[model samples]
Target: MPLLLAFLFVSATVWVTRQAAAARTLTFLMTISTVVTLGLIAFFLFAEAIPVFERMGVRILLPLEGEMWDPNTNTFSLVPMIWGTAITTIVAILVAGPLGVAGALFISEIAPEQVREIVKPGVEILAGIPSIVYGFIGFTIINPYVSSELSTGFGALLPIGVVIGFMALPTVVSVAEDAISTVPESMKSGALAMGATDWQTMKSVTVPAAFSGISAAVLLGLGRAIGETMAATVMIAHVKELPQPAYDVFDSGETLTTLIAGNFGPAVGTEYLLSALFAAGVVLFLIVTAISITSQYIEERMKRKLGGEV
Candidate 1:
């Protein structure tokens, strides 16, 4: 089997990598293999999506008011889902970014060794919780609470976004904490030596120093939120229309992930619906890839800023 050959090849390559020359060669091969694998996936995804575009024209990518995503009726507009994904992800990032950064700062700069020992691990443990559990919490508690108290739809945007934000929080906290920890003590010491208060030094030196990594952490959180399936599925209704008023976070909606996830059983052999779903997948891929590439650029710039290079 191809998998067995790949496994044996990898094993033999790893053995050969015990020598320095073959190690570099094998590393290059591995990197190329990964890149090629990703390329193939992207190619196939786009290829599968082409049928929808050809059948429906580019109207599939346009915003709503006309057609909503009922594939049984052959309507395949993607904008409402895009809007849902964007709104929820924006809410999630807005919630997670500041909180995660603050958590990171507290853990890296303010917490004593014993406190860091406890809190940091506790935060990381949150990352291990199954996302489905978060979904259940949202569906059971937050959704009903919002529906009762706020008098909104049970599957409102704000509550679902908040749940996703909290789900992403531990990742942001962990990565941002590492970024803060990477800040040289010398920089903080210099600020202190200049008669800066600890708070002032942290505000001026540590945060700025760690800003890019923090930024990347936030982007990663956004990516997680955008790609989230189980939580979004459980917490939100599968409505395909744009939210009434468009600005109301209390509106029920479908997200890109939930769209793909929710329709699979029904979409099994239906060409247009399947293709539209794949097209959604393609869009999701592009958006996430753009975020990842931007994060990488920011990280590189951060490295240059920290390294005393022009």
Candidate 2:
């Protein structure tokens, strides 16, 4: 009997080692594929955009002043669109960050087990809903409300920011909940045994322990808001110029993603216009890429720290 048990144990060890090696190989291959794909995309974007600089000179599109993106007038300043993207993204993050983290904490720590199961799926379902549907809701419901209450036209920046913030909420909550769940149960138990209240344990122990993951989730949400297109295009007033005070959230404006999606088809006929749009694409790409890289780095660092590899 003893020999039979030893033989089974050895067999299980061998099987587990084989599986681990296969997983490592698969991960390496996937990493290489992703890097190669991103490199190709970057190369193509630059190749398409270089022509605009050559034909019109960088001064035409990049001048800080006298830069209006009037295609008819041959002016292609991107400052307004850039500012619009920044404002909308910043506002969305500010709104989504706290709500998402709180929702995550509720599900992971405060909720009953059965309730957590129900709420988690609902949050994930929100992420799966089409972006265009969210846009439609924003256009039909949010726009009218803002227009009526604020006595402003539809497509104001505040409504767009709020809508995008909602769109990003599911992503932040899902990721943050997963992170909070990964915290060791023993830590929570120890805190409670040491006379800490449930809320105190969660606030001091679980949240701080999972801070990196929560931050990564927020950054990911920000990236999603920054790159949203159809929703922003439909909901935003789509003004091509900057707001009067430049910080006015009540004014309508354009983002890079919205600008590219809305204008790419019509601009295709003109080489310089197409190239200029490609330049905008490059900018959006770089921003999203940077956010993604930062999120990934933080996640990896957190994993290492949790695994005691740091």
Candidate 3:
């Protein structure tokens, strides 16, 4: 029996290594299986979400006049959370976008080879750090700074958004740098030959050519910002209303992700409250999905464009 098991394992390994067709077929099956899990997730979210809609109608998503999202009074509004998500994402993108692009440009184009070697790996290392570390940092340091300096209170959006933006930076830098690096050297040479400086060539020839990929990187960062939960939850307050002024980022509030995450434990078997959280999950899922799909599409376009296929 031991000999038979060893033989089977060895034969399977040989089959996997030697047979390209079999290996590819197995990999394809694995990939398709992952798609099935994604489908299941979508199904579960909607399954859990639709009940809230049925019970409270669509107005549950819109802002109501009184206490927003009070499960006790049966008042369930999602607008405040939605607003929080939107504003935080916007601020994150704004903070991360230019800095990430600049970092990418410097590493891929301007930095010395030694500097690039050091900086690129360092930047990549940031991505490996856990989100909870970011949350703790925000909860401990940034939260207090913002509350004291900006008069925004403990859970203000400015600090939360900025922290989230830095969290998204590695993705933006990695993607954008790859895109910028793909620009043909000949393009830069041509621009330089036409009396453009290194800076001008980079601005005119490299950056413009790689703009689609950079845009995709920004969108990817947007997706990250939209989906961030733990950091925002730790950094934000459980404010149950929309900010008094619609555009106020300083006002403390919970995002949809934070709302669901903060409530999931307490909401166990609490019918409408559980449903409400799931409803928030549904909206969060859709927004993140749309941003990811759009980012992917743009990345594909960038690849095609860079390859001269488009």
Candidate 4:
């Protein structure tokens, strides 16, 4: 509906401009509508968010200093879930970053036109696949393989990480491909004309030119991996205890999203449960927002370095 209204407004603005003497009015209307839309969205997110935190003792902020998450015990430390979410996202991004960049490079720089056309569609199709399908695939295929080959028990994290890496792959590929493709062709041609190797040109010049976009893509992928609930829920063992010191990659851990999803139904209407879920949400929001802000800052810095902006 927002998009439809945007399109209709644009059409009306164009029509008014064509008629003469009404362009200013149309522009004013467009500005007002855009502000009103943004204000409404902000109001909604903030309104619900306040109550959610209020119930969770957010004003007192006890969860930060507490030890356990059990509500009946009045223990509500969020460190474990926070650690799990951070570690999983970090591991998944480490795996996905290089692979996603390589995939994007192949599509944007190396593949022949015909091959690119064929492969691009397949990559886009991956993004269209349902999250539940990925979850089922992770649970049925990846989980058992990890449990059998990696350890005698507690081998779920590795599979969930891999599944998340796969799930975020399409986003990274699509976004990074656009970034790589946007690199000035003249720069590539100049490097090639100077007798530089294809790999050298890509590594030293093209990728540097596209670094901001690649970073943005990576941040977006990390956001998706961090917020993913169903695949993690299905694939992970949903361990309640803190992960052991061994730090086995195969061991399962509960992330913030999985923790909330697993507990919400049973804890409904209970202030503790409601507050806990909201706290998780608040944490997720902060993490994603941080990523976005960092991406924008990097983008701005890169633009300045590249002289795209000053």
Candidate 5:
């Protein structure tokens, strides 16, 4: 039976490989598989979360005034977690944006060929380092320094934001570098021939021309920051309350990703608590999906503006 099954599998593989129509059909099937998988995931999340919505209504899930998330006591306001996610993402962008753009500009426009080759690879290598390693570094190195020098706390947003920013920097730098490098050499030459300095040409011409790509890169980085989980779960203080004054980066806070990661285990037997976690997952999925769609749209627009077809 095994021999016969193996022979049948080999025959099918060989037949598919030999036929163009078969190959195309397989590709279409794979694409549909991805869409189907995503649909099922969304459906599962919504289905699991529906119980909570039915039991408590939408107000409990999205309360405007209350700031607690105690499932044992029955409170389930997600505002604090939502705010934490937002503030951390914004802080990461603010830290990573200028540094990433400057690094891209330096590598693409200013560095000598040898220097550019070395620096670009080095920057790209940072992306391959595991997120857990970054989390460990933040917890061990950054947290202590901040505790001694600034505030004595576990969940200051600055250090976590900076670490997450570094994690996201490679994406921004790589995309922006590719975008800047794609600017036609003729444009730079024209500017130089007209007596424009290199800096002037880069600042006034190359950057403006690549703004759409840069914007897409930033959005992609923001998505990365928002969706990061293990690193944040380890480094953040994981407080359940809203930050005092609502703008305090130094206060301990908890993000949706971390909240879900840290609490889902205990919530398994509790129906409403598990559903609430699933609901948070749905929220995160929507946020990341929106950012990805926006990034793709910007990239498509940039390509069209550059005379490329869709």
Candidate 6:
């Protein structure tokens, strides 16, 4: 809709230019309006929750930071849920990061042109798959296998990490591939001309040149992994406990998204439960916002560096 409005405004400006000489002024006004609209939408997400947090008071943090997450008792300790999110996020990134980078390198640097053309579309299809489909696949295939064969009662983290890793793979691969593809041909040629192997050339020259893009890809994957609700909520059982039962990957644990999702429907009132839910949302919002801002900074730096405008 914004695009359509922008298009119509531009078209109207072009028509008005035939009658008046102030078309440039109209164009600038249109541009500023579009930016304001976008900024309003972005700002609303942060401002909407302030009232909820303000009413709850600092007493809310006691429960949020304490050992347990008993909303009925007016306790709102976020330690357990925070730990679950942090651990799973770390695990998913650890699994997805290197694999995504390698896949990007393969697609851009090593794959034959024809092979790349054929495979790249298929790679993108993975990202287009729905979160519910991933959840179904994890529940039917991975979860049961872990419970029946791997051990007695592990139900969450490892499977979710692996599945989220798969879901994140395409985003990372596509972004990193674009980064690698942008490396100057002269750089690659020079490395090869110096008798460096293809692998060495990619490792030393192409990878470093595209490091910012790869970093953006990893951060994007992190956001995707952290914010993922349906797949993680479905595949992992929701428990309020902090410590992992057995240091086992299969153990059930709750993430902030999972907790928000599973409890929001049943949670209500000015009670601890409702306050805790908002607190969880606050944590998720902060983490995702921080990551997004960092990613933008890296992307801008990369653009300036690559364009030699820095």
User: What local distance difference test score does each model get?
Assistant: 0.90, 0.87, 0.88, 0.79, 0.85, 0.80
Q: What is candidate 1's lDDT per residue for 5-112, written digit by digit as tens?
A: 986787687777566765776688789889999999999999999989998788888874566777767878998899999889989988898999999999999999
Selected candidate, larger TM-score, 1 vs 5: 1
List, residue by residue over 46-155, the lDDT tens digit for candidate 4: 55446545544543233244345667754565666776776778778877888999999999989999999999899989988988899998878777777778663543
Weakest lDDT window of 10 consecutive positions for candidate 1: 63-72
Model 5 Cα lDDT, one tens digit per residue, 1-310: 9966775686578666777765676577669868999999999988998877776677654645554776776668677888889888988998778888999999999999999989999999998999999999999989889878886577677778888988999989998898888888999999999999999999888997888878887887898899888788889998878888689887778899999999989998898899888888888989888888888888778768766565
Models 1 onward score TM values of: 0.95, 0.87, 0.90, 0.83, 0.89, 0.82
Q: Of the candidates shown, which would achieve the greatest TM-score relative to the real structure?
A: 1
Give the TM-score comparing model 2 with the true structure, all chains together.
Answer: 0.87
lDDT of 3 by residue, 59-109 (tens): 987778788888887679999999988999999999889999999999998
Alpha-carbon shift of residue 42 in model 2 (angstroms): 0.2
In model 6, how large is the Cα lDDT of residue 7?
A: 71
What does the lDDT read for residue 84 in candidate 6? 79
Clashes of each: 0, 1, 0, 0, 0, 8
Where in model 1 is the C-alpha error above 4 Å? 2-18, 308-310
lDDT (Cα) of model 6:
0.80
Candidate 3 vs candidate 5: the TM-score winner is 3
Better of 1 and 6 by lDDT: 1
lDDT of 2 by residue, 47-159 (tens): 99887767667663453565477677566777788899999998999888999999999999989999988999999999998999999999999999989999876798888
